[model samples]
Target chain A: MSPVSQTRSPLDWVKTAISRYWGVVGVLIAWQAWVTITGVNSIVIPHPINVVGDLVFNPGVYLANAGQTLFLAAAGLILGMALGTMVAIVAWSSRILSGILVPLGLIFSSVPVVALIPVLARLLGYDVKTVLGIVIIISFFPAFVFTAAGLKSLPPGSSDLFKVFGASRWTRFVHLVLPSAVPNWMIALRLSAPPAVLSAMLAEFLMGKSGLGFLFRQSATEFATERAFGTSVIATVISVLCFTSAVAAEKFINEKWK
Target chain B: MNAPLSSAPATAPEAWAINVDHVGKTFTLDGGKELKAIDDVDIKIGQGEFVALLGPSGCGKSTILRLVAALEDVSTGRVTVEGSNPTALSRAHRLGVAFQDHALLPWLTIRDNIALPYKVAGRPVDDKRIAELLALVGLSGFEKARPRQLSGGMRQRVSIARALVLKPDVLLLDEPFGALDAVTRRHMNVELQRIWSEQRITTLLVTHSVEEALFLADRVIVMSGRPGRIIKEIQVPFARPRSPDVQRTMEFHHLADELTLALEPEGHH
Candidate 1:
């Protein structure tokens, strides 16, 4: 074998890594070039380097706010998914209930869900609980709709087989319906994860004592332009991480379920 | 090998394993109109007997099978098994059924699919029985494979093994090999015959193939389409352990021709 084929060099490894992350590298290069060329006032749009400097110098501020936001988002997501799944199971138990709730769920899901945040803040009072509630409401509809669809979409002829096998209603639900619904449920999870985080931050921005959203507002008002931009960077990182993890979880479940 | 057959006693009031007593079915369409699918159809299957309901497409032969399997209720009459309602048999987990779709759970391994009836009945999973069925179906080495990974014929074999896992008192097969090619279907028929001979469970098979019905059934009942009713019944004269050679016999050909003629369109007659 040729030496090049037998042993890969350090330069070859670097070349592969660059090719894989070229898009991200290109975006960073373009942002730096645009800032340098325009020389826009730092107050309007901080330099990328200034934002990085803010993040590095003041880690405690970012860390505390990010921790709070992540906690609220994760907790609210769990609560909303549980509530949605319970309601779906209740609807599945009765034709009359399903008929009543399915259309209502569709209506609620189609409505501008984020638009309700202000109204919810007014009604529930501008507290951390309201922020949590907003995230819950944002995530609930997809879980309900996707799970309802999954419960009904059984393998062809398997329902008849279940009936003929003398399966009880509970047995059928446990073995057939629940397992079948898992992949769709994972789809709902992946679709809702990033939005869950975004909505939590938005709620915090509207009326919260502390969070990344509050930090952004505080920094901007005080003319700490670099700190505000740093908050945005952290928020973006968090959302991407949440979305990537959700996608990975969905792939894992789909492989097992299908 | 002579399997022990569970034939009913001669003095028993219900000697029949399955009785479709003047059963009729009517289905409602999208509109308020009613379409009669079966009309005054009657069938009696003896214990340990293999009977085939043979009819062309659109005939209610499958409807009759569905009635006996308790998948559908008769609109005008009753279907009974062992002197009780068909639903009783199903509820007791003594009825086995295989449909044309195979109906194997795609997510489950072949062994788990066979063991599903046990789980449904709230009985412990019998690993030995599942292994035995896997061997019987000629799928011993494929126990860990999923249904989608197998060929169509192999999937149907897994379906059949699942049906027999509980050693159900009655077996209902609705064109289990209907999705296969001609050669594969014929091969399935031979395998099914050997399997049925060994089990000797009371079986009702629904199919449109004249040769399949004759080759596998102890008796063949032909039905007419559009408000399905029995047109004719023929007792298969072939002995047990019937090999593929029986299909080449003159008697088999004559019976096949008769059944084919029965299935022809009314205009042709």
Candidate 2:
């Protein structure tokens, strides 16, 4: 059955929208109510309305920082996935290589990736490249692990069929092994993509001159609470967008592939 | 109907398209214990002959087919096709095969799935041959349909079409309809018989169904489980271009019952 069913009526669309987004809506309403009840000083914690005003009024500032962060995250995610897939294929091909690399990959994945950012910044220099590296490192493990598993889980008896047909190594990889890994690769993407955005922002926050992370830091230091709150709101939106888009892509591919 | 296992002639090697020369296969278990899957099995399929290996589950009839398909190495003796090693036939892209799972690539359309042999063989896709096969399998209009869109029987048909597209010297079918319902399986046997009559390619089918074996094969070799060995061999007396009504005949039932009795456990009444 198709997961992307069409809505039959306007009422159906509204019901679906509420079911999907009620949690986020509820959180927003609670935050607004708390701000109104407290009557807190604006400099300490600005009203939700004030944060929205800053976002609406100063689109140019937010746009430039957001664009930078988006580019870094997207670029890092693609490179990481590509590298992971290549390594996985190499591991699949050579027993010795997999024996050495798979365990190492596991170890790297187990360590807190966020903790590595400051150390990486010191070694790689405090720049955009480090932020990109952080994002890449964060995204790599899931892709590598999932792709390796997928490569092994071919359709039942397909490996035997290919052997009987006398498929060349490269031909088998292209026609059988690579395509087999697609669904699992989509899974890696869904798991890694949202984290890619978060890692990029965190790297920017630690040691960077631009991006939403730096904007947030600058606003907080200067007592511009509304701007800081606006950056957080934008960051949350971007992260959620990444997650949803990855999920959508996965569903679309699985419909055709599975 | 049961004949001595070794009575098969050891004459001209060229006449035999697939020759399993006293083959045996053993597997090393995870615990390092040896498990004998097949032992001292011999089968010689003549050129354009249809032979079916019928046995119960775990009887290693499939292992025999796998040996001839060059998918597994025989622990003892050898398997040859057309006077050369079985692997050689595979390397030449002259071996066709279908299994219980169908094994069609789900992402591809029916036409492309059938054309996969050509792609694997590094030959240009033959559109005419693919069309011919699609029609041969009675799936001509389903060229654009992916494997997921088709029924199980339809998918198996596509796998069969793909196997035959290359016009291989030998066809190996390992329970190609084993997963289908009774009605569909019977229908498929009729379809396969019709298809085989046109091509007349030498085929070796592994199955558990006595009726199916009797219906589709010129000869049936039944095996006993546990270090599998051929226990009974029967030359089917049914004429070519056999109709489904042949199954209702007394002679067919007589053969089926005999084979079924042979398949039963020794102590079972």
Candidate 3:
């Protein structure tokens, strides 16, 4: 892929980008055309230009709420992943613990995390902490499931090698098992990141006083369609950023590991 | 430490480095069926002896190696290494092993992979020892290379370096070259012969190749498959520091033929 790309000129990069993102460009063009053709009221469905205009003109408002949402998402993601990995290690250390925790994990994963947000908000008093809790719960399932599976995926004959080397449980876990799980852990990260952003926004929309979700809700309630659409655009960009960064991180780690 | 099974009086206690006393292993399959992997296998190695257990695939040769490596338990008998249980030898960090898969950690450089045993045993890393081993395995200047960057043969060399890094009392190899191409395998055997001569650790190599067994072992114990049992034991006559040229000799061919014939199916034999 690199060799072929190197042979091509700068124009090819433009061509590749167009090929990759044509669908998005086409959708934007179609949305603009529909709004212009239907002559819809700007209050009902603002033009894309109006949405972009609101984003550019109201940078401070969007930035503040985006900052809050980003903080909640990033913090919840890290804490949830850390908690899940710790639980996975504990389960791996004992068969009885694994037998109990794995089924409970499956059950928890099966239920929709969004449904728990309202109940949790009621219990935790409809605050930022509840929003954070919702994000953490949303992100925890993949981390736990993927990490549990990853801990068991030892490289071929590595278990035998460790046993033959007289490695204690701690030694094996640190040197062998933990490193083996990294690739799978990265997968969990990539899977959970986008949802983490979305869940944080959802939680904020339901009951928070700030964040992209609350910003969207407040804008829509006030009939500020352009600001609401701008909020959505910002949320989408953040989600995409999270996904691409996770993918980049996964690629870098996989290259170094394998 | 003396072995717990001291009642076996046929041999003196300390002379044997590894003693597999009538060891048998039966694995219970799913649905309550029993599969006997090995049956009443008895073998003993003197200090510094290079013994080979040669058999076909699924002949339980690897099972015997596993028993000695303390990776598997013997059902009916005991396997003692260095006058104690195999586990004792391993726990003391006195056993080294290499397998067909070349089980070097992909994440580590060659140098770190070779240095792993020291880390596992809670010893400080010995840079000089690791360098010496890298040089000995003909892998000098390749220290920073990971296993993936190396060829199949080079990866095997790294695994061998890791096994020998601690100067272990016993080196157990189960088909260490079984996955290599024939030419590379032969070359590795030559390199291994040189390596083994330098250390002279009590070694037990398990292989299915007749030539490999004849070329490497001081004594080759051949086993039959399906409830594996020893079929023959032949003492190799080639002197130590044996060159690869000895493989072309008339006596070597005769021995190779004999072992090959023994390894055939029962009717053919």
Candidate 4:
């Protein structure tokens, strides 16, 4: 509110950077230690070294597949988050809407969507549209539920404050309800991201070319367990990266709006 | 007699700022039960009058204030502000409110918090008005300070300044000083009186403390429970520019005790 300096001090920068990477550093060191001590078969858990070599040198044979998977997941996640927030606004605005959306969303979520892959293939034709649709369906409901509940959960006094001010519907969405609901949205996104990634993978496995899932299916056919294992690790790292970035973005928004 | 508020405010009383007539509210519990929060509330508050809706907890004192502020609707009657229906008063700058909690946005600094209504309505922040508000609330030096950086009393002061920045026709304060320590609350009471007198703004405060209600209000309306309704109205014959010393006078206690007795349990009566 005040005219304060925009830049962080050097000490503040160091603190922020360390906090962000602390888990990553711990994971690397622990992973190296585990490889040295376990002496397990390389097929089950390739040394982090071999995984990194494949990640860098093979430079995305599977990574390219991973890139495609990431694209689908990212697109699906964004569509889901945006549309989910809008659904929440609708649900919150009218009791009738909540009633309608509740049963619709529940039924949508029930009946394992993975089972409908062939239906989707029949409709959208075995392609990325089909894969992203899977991600959208898997990712959207939780976001919608949380966003709706979060908006509705604003403290009595807060809503009253907005009401007294005669705030526009959109204004309340952008200001009062949105800022207060950041924590809930973050929790939903964390819950939804892994499934969204998995959904994309499943769709890719079922559908076609270019994705870590395709690599996974191909490697399984060849019985190259190490490559499959490596691909799995790479997939995991991608998920973590995606989830972490989403979480960090949420945290930054929370802090800025706090 | 529940009715929508009218948008017409083409003409209004030169004397009174708020008018209520048998306005009431009741909430239906989850199982289709009803809880009466307020009932048959009627009051004609003059322009620039400092009044308190005082009663014990659950007496619906706060509910009355919220109704006038247009935060909630009346169940069976009507309420108006500046001779206009509050519910239909669609402008954001018309009423300034401060509640028990400061409710200052933690993200914004003291100045921005004060300047928020303007900025939120797409009007640019008026720096001069912001500075004047900060100076008035004794937050002049901390304009850039975030709500979290300030102490409790300091935060409440910022809240007050924020409410005042818009120069609202009425100021609705719901136990604004209740959360502060003894000393800070007393100091704020004095500061509030000064601001009220200087601005000549109509104020409606809801409070449980008899002395606090007595010290601040020009007239205090006491209410009774369950189906909450006004039980008595007592006038504070005290002089203007209220200071802490005015609290020690016999007249203050006389009114305080009268309001307190009105709020006591009905069995004893």
Can you give the DockQ of every candidate in the order shown?
Answer: 0.75, 0.81, 0.75, 0.28
DockQ of model 2 vs. true complex: 0.81
**Regarding TM-score, does 3 or 4 come out ahead?**
3
lDDT (tens digit, per residue) of candidate 3 on B44-96: 88788898899988989999999999999999998889888899989989899
Regions of candidate 2 where Cα sits further than 4 Å from its true position: A1-34, B1-9
Residue B149: error of model 1 in Å?
A: 2.1
- lDDT leader: 2
- How many clashing pairs per prediction, in order? 0, 0, 0, 3
Candidate 1 Cα deviation (angstroms), residue B226: 1.4
Docking class of 2: high
Give lDDT per model, in order.
Answer: 0.89, 0.92, 0.91, 0.79
Tens-place lDDT digits, model 2, residues A1-258: 438567488888898899989998898889889878988788887888888899999999999999999999999999999989999999999999999999999998787866898888888999999999988888889999999999999988899999999999999999999999999999999999999999899889878899999999999999999999999999999999999999999999998898
* C-alpha-based local distance difference test score of model 2: 0.92
Ranking by TM-score: 3, 2, 1, 4
Please give the distance, in angstroms, between residue A232's alpha carbon in candidate 3 and its true position after superposition: 1.0
- The reply for model 1, stretches above 4 Å from the true place, is A1-23, A103-115, A122-125, B1-13, B265-269
Chain A fold similarity by TM-score, each prediction: 0.90, 0.91, 0.94, 0.76
**Model 4 segments more than 4 A misplaced:** A1-57, B1-14, B22-42, B72-78, B88-92, B105-110, B119-124, B141-151, B225-232, B250-269
Q: What lDDT does candidate 4 reach at residue B116?
A: 71
Which model is ahead, 2 or 4, in terms of TM-score?
A: 2
Question: What does each candidate score in C-alpha RMSD?
Answer: 3.9, 2.7, 3.1, 7.0
Clashing pairs in 2: none
